[model samples]
Target chain A: MTSRVIFPHKVLPYLLLVPQIAITLVFFYWPASQALRQSTLREDPFGLVTTFVGLGNFRQVLSDPDYIGSVQTTIIFSAATALIPMAIALVLAVMADKVIKGRGFYRTLMIWPYAVAPAIAGMLWLFLFNPTIGTFAYMLRRAGYDWDPLLNGNQAMLMIIMAAAWKQISYNFLFFVAGLQAIPKSLLEAAAVDGAREVKRFWTIVFPLLAPTSFFLLVVNTVYAFFDTFGIIHAVTSGGPGKATETLVYKVYNDGFVNLMLGSSAAQSVILMGIVIALTAIQFRYVERKVHYA
Target chain B: MPERTEAGTTSRSRRSPWVSHAVLIAGILIVVFPIYYTFVASTLSLQQILRPPLQLLPGSHFLDNYYEALFGGLGRVGGINVWTLLLNTSIVALSVAVGKIVISILSAYAIVFFRFPFRMTFFWVIFITLMLPVEVRILPTYKVMVDLGLIDTYTGLTLPLMASATATLLFRQFFMTIPGELLEAARVDGAGPWRFFFDFVLPLSKTNIAALFVILFIYGWTQYLWPLLVTNSNDMNTIIIALRKMISYADADTQWHLVMVTTIFAILPPVAVVVLMQRWFVKGLVETEK
Candidate 1:
């Protein structure tokens, strides 16, 4: 994959690779291997002894009802976070693309939320929806709806979902805009000449053509919801209201750091790693084909 | 052909463009409402915030609230002022951005420019790290940090997160596009690897480097979970982490006005970078993923 003519350095190449390789091994590989090793080992109460229990931790974790609940929570959270913003973004992107004027203006105004930290975004929503003090909460109460995320599990999940989805709309909007632009105007024009209406043409032609981008975004958003929304969960609910908001990642942290269940946490870590591997593999398989779309 | 089709469509549908504009305007309002509400709340007095249906417009207490947040009016978080948190975040961001770029560029160059043994092995080693994000390896990674005595240190904050496989992959992809003639020409001029790297490669990669820096800086600035775990002291907290500490969910005495002010301060820098360097930010995001 390199050039035909290149440097013939032996030591310099290794020297150049040292920093990245070192950091990767120490921080990435070592910890990962440790997770694997620790998954099978259980420590005593006093932290003095580690007895090897092959597959015991994984068996216990899989059987635990709380772990199962967390798995369901992750599934619902990821699905909602992925779909809600994407649907909204597609609508906004189509409208932005259709508008003849202020296209760039709308894009500018809309995209800065991508830059907001998930935690900060969570804070904004929490403040606005704070039951006792929130402006929106006050209005909702006036409108005769019960409003309190702090006490209600379903409401808390909704709050984090809204915050996470809100932050991600800008990213999805950008990609959808790019995807729409990549479709050939000639195709739509051809459909028009054949007596197809605009909305019908979009459904039959444009929507099908955006399949690649849509599929790619599905994978990306899943990963984002899976890993990147840690801040939002931590800040907004801390997996509260009876662990309704704890995703797999949050559970791993809580079990490991907060609850001090080393073996169980390590097992959960290994499970998460498997999930990432599967998701990443799916992404690469799709993206490999989509690479030449340009 | 396309122009005629456009005219045909226009005649078939005399729908007002105002509808599209109105829809987009509504979308923008919803998207921007929370941010604007935060800013307005930051300027109000405690009484104003405590009362429901506070005025939509900003109150007259902007300077007082901000002054209180910035100074030690409310007892400083971890004895560190807002400025300290801001400074710590900036340092982490700049270091992570610069460090990832430098190391990734060098590794990419090494892989692309020279025929070294075990090259693919090393590449795969780095590639595998992508599957092992810090979230999945939280306990073990913290153990490693604790063992290495890097906890509560800047190195702990920045170093573990800097092994960027995506960045290296991007640089490698870009380097593969470099014209072979340039390297041949540099070789003819008797340029060493270092010389070619400094003179030719560095200059040629300026745009890519700039784009990557913008994306990575935001990534660094917005980090929460890692910093939350590694840094225990109040002074060591980044703004994102510090903001969490500032809010007391259970207490009636939580400083609502100051929390709002701190939220604005926490959001401004990265958002400013995104808006200011919009072109490169978009390009960097699109290119890196591919």
Candidate 2:
């Protein structure tokens, strides 16, 4: 009787977590474990018996030039996407902050791009960049400069980066606005009294205070650019005229779903997961220290 | 001296009302122009769209383009029905939103208000999952869905995403701000945990719940990748995927008009939701971040 009473008192709190645990196990852990298992095996179509390939699949995926190129593309894409949006967002936020009027209007307008779905965003841009009928293409032709993202690697990469950055600017703006708002008004007043100019005040006082928000956005944006761009890439270019836009996640989706290389795809997924985890851990450990809580 | 200077500075800093309106109007134009362009493009003919300098105004071909895009036509592989896609997308989004909110509230209540062993560890585990991208886990998730016989079903699209670690974390942080005395008082009044949760806690959390609802609804509605992977039939496909299929079909001959029409149709619902629920969405972000 005593044990029963104690059990209800003690375990009731933990019991509430049961739903979350169950869902995560089924959706997250089970699939993750299955992926790990599949990564180690060589399974053919028709669900036939699979042989243990050990590290063979990993070696093949890693050594292939296409996969190596994808890694390079992933790194460049992630870095550019993360850094560019952040820089643009920071500038916009500062400008918006300095403006004496229409703060709410600016905030709302700036965040508008985030509302559009990624696939639609890609389609929208694709229409704008269409070779035969595109507005931008027509304008370029008028200017005597031939423009076709479909034909050039550099242009394709630029298109992906621009599209990703455009969608992400709103998110970055939101966070930056929130971060800017969190700065105590008294500090700004004090800096103004100290004869610090607007730019100087921002660089020294405001920027340091916004570090935590920046760091958080950096990690989130990197992951987003790394993994979330798959849908856009799939919709817009399908990795393009010469596989110029194929990032790691895109390759995984292509191999697993389109190419029907389930085992090899699983191996690629594992490698992708490892790289992301390592990058995230390193960012959290190193960059997080610079964040000013106050 | 400081007081006088501060008052003078405040007076100097205040901008004229006209200036504020001008800034707001300019900002609004920049933001709304692309969407306006989309609507205009949707109304024009293919030839008009291809014309140099582009048509800045809406054309008379809106109905025809929309009709052809929605129903298959010459040079179009159109099998999509927009209404059906919208219904499917809404069903999936609503279920995920409701499921995620309920689960998150319960999990957060347990973690924040009660004394439980391994609580910190559990929280860490939940946080860790946030770092693990869905891309890495998609294959395994697909296999599990297949095993459960969920393929091409609404349940398959909704179930895996129904429980979000981010929501749980947000709720946990929100719950922590509530006073312990409220819970203790309810307990002293002979209220059990469930009764206390329903009677005392939930009513106070309406704003947070609403905010979470908007965010989750938008996230779920706009979800493309997983749904695209799982659903095979046009009947089962959501609006975003349907948009993608339409665009790909229009790729070769490049029917800009039809593509624009379908794109506008695809974007309308989510944009409506966002504009309508903007207050709650912004509120939720501010509250959770705090």
Candidate 3:
């Protein structure tokens, strides 16, 4: 929607737009277009020759067992990373909402973790759960639990997931708190007047009304798990225990930067680009319909 | 009594207030325990931490460990001290936050306040960038950095990161909410684009700018992967990347004491920012994401 009243300046607007446009073109568009182009081309190991191979990199990347395993890992990682924190946050938000006194105090304490860097969060958890030197790991072994995340793939995945989820809980908690606050009090009061029990009142009134916020957080937490948790994985597990925690983003970095498999990495990057586009589309669609809830 | 019961059920009485506080206190403990343990670990000696099930209480070596961490250079990271890493991180975070605000506000002003050809085209261009995070286009972006000779440079670390859509979109959304009459009144008084921007737009967006600053500074400070790839030298390392360097996955190679110390240092500024600017931080977060 254009503003009805606007300056009729010709060159000034273009001048004003230069810095953002220039940066976007150089850093964002150029690299993205290059990824597309590089995905179709292969460079020889000797760095002496280049050949155009149409769709071959995509074919190889898609067919590779390691790549397939990484995709499976990403799905599991993203789902758990998205859900665990969301569930924890929802419970905390509900509790905070119910408490009449010290609501702000509890919120302040809880939200501080939102500021902790994911890598730092991962490190804290890593130190606490490190099989040999970790405090909790010591407790676990004493209890007869086999707690070596470094040696077991599933255990390693769980560790990173917890670290990732721990960092995200504050974010989801804040959103859920905001969501809970937005529900009309009259609706709940009416349910209570009808002799609906507290749990029944919440299920019949609050949960249904909170669908929009829940849906929005779902999309956001999915995006966070997909892209932003790279730091936690890198710091905590480094996608270890036989690539068990190797997410799509981590694999892209590993293949391109570490292994120098540019063609395959670029193909994987293009596929990631498609995934992001799909997610962004869903988000924008939500934005269009968001006004109804408001 | 019945009236009080009804009133309580409406807002605050789904359960006893004690139950809510109890659950919330437990939640807070779970959230804070890792950091608390890290803090406890930071103050202890290496031998203390190396031994499993370290004491939960504070240690006697707090001053000594902190002194070493603040002044002592990590041997693995080329002896660059924590202070320099903190300074580097501050520069990156401040520059990214300020630079993004400047560029985005200007663009949003142009798009919202002026009638220009291809304006929607430019908006779409910036909007599409939301989908292309550094994770997806890692290699090509790094290539651009190398080709531009920006590797290990401060500009390299912060500039590529500033190329995002969130701030511009946020500014655009805020600008749209501004009353049209304000611009009309300025125009009638013969205020040009530059004058309107400085006098009306800038002043109007003061709170928004502050809010965005809090959020963006944290975003800049917490960056891990991009800085990891761009800066190879210890001298160029931000605090987050430096923390990663100081850590060794192998048990024996790592100094748990110093690592804990650096972890606290790494998190302090951003956490302080969030706590100090809690109101604006929350506002900026909800606004930008939604």
Best by TM-score: 3
Sort all candidates by lDDT, best to worst: 1, 3, 2
What tier of docking accuracy does candidate 3 attain? Answer: medium
lDDT of 3 by residue, B1-290 (tens): 22334575545574578888888999999999998898899999999999989899889889998998887777667899888899999999999999999989989888888887899999999999998999989999999999999999999999988865889988988999889899889999999888888898899899899999998898899989989989988899998888877775354867788888888888789888998899888887876774
Select the stronger candidate by DockQ from 1 and 3.
Answer: 3
lDDT digits (tens) for residues A1-294 of candidate 3: 543788887999999899999999999999999999999999999767989999999999999999999999999999998899889999999888787678778888888778888888888898999987899999999999999998999989988888889988989998888888778776777777788988887788888887887888888889989999999888878889889999999999999999998999999999999999999999889977988778
For model 2, residues A1-294, the per-residue Cα lDDT tens digits are 112111136877777888888878788877888888889999767768799999889999989999999889888988998988898778777667555556776776766667787767676677667677668777887789878888987777887787787778777877887788778767777887788776687789899988888877888788788877777888888887687999998999889888888888999988977977786686667444744354
Residue B98 displacement in candidate 3 (angstroms): 0.9
Question: Which has the better lDDT: candidate 1, or candidate 2?
Answer: 1
Q: What is the C-alpha RMSD of each candidate to the true structure, in Å?
A: 2.1, 4.2, 2.2
Fraction of native contacts under 8 Å reproduced by each candidate: 0.75, 0.49, 0.82
lDDT per residue (tens digit) for residues B136-192 in model 1: 999888989999999899999999888899899999989888888999999999999
Which model is ahead, 1 or 3, in terms of TM-score? 3
lDDT by residue (tens digit), candidate 1, A1-294: 433687988899999999999999999989999999999999998899999999999999999999999999999999999999899998898887677678878988898788899999999998899897788999999999998898889999999999999998998888888888778777877787898887898799878888887888889999999999999999889998889999999999999999999999999999999999999899888878986776
TM-score of chain B of each: 0.93, 0.85, 0.94
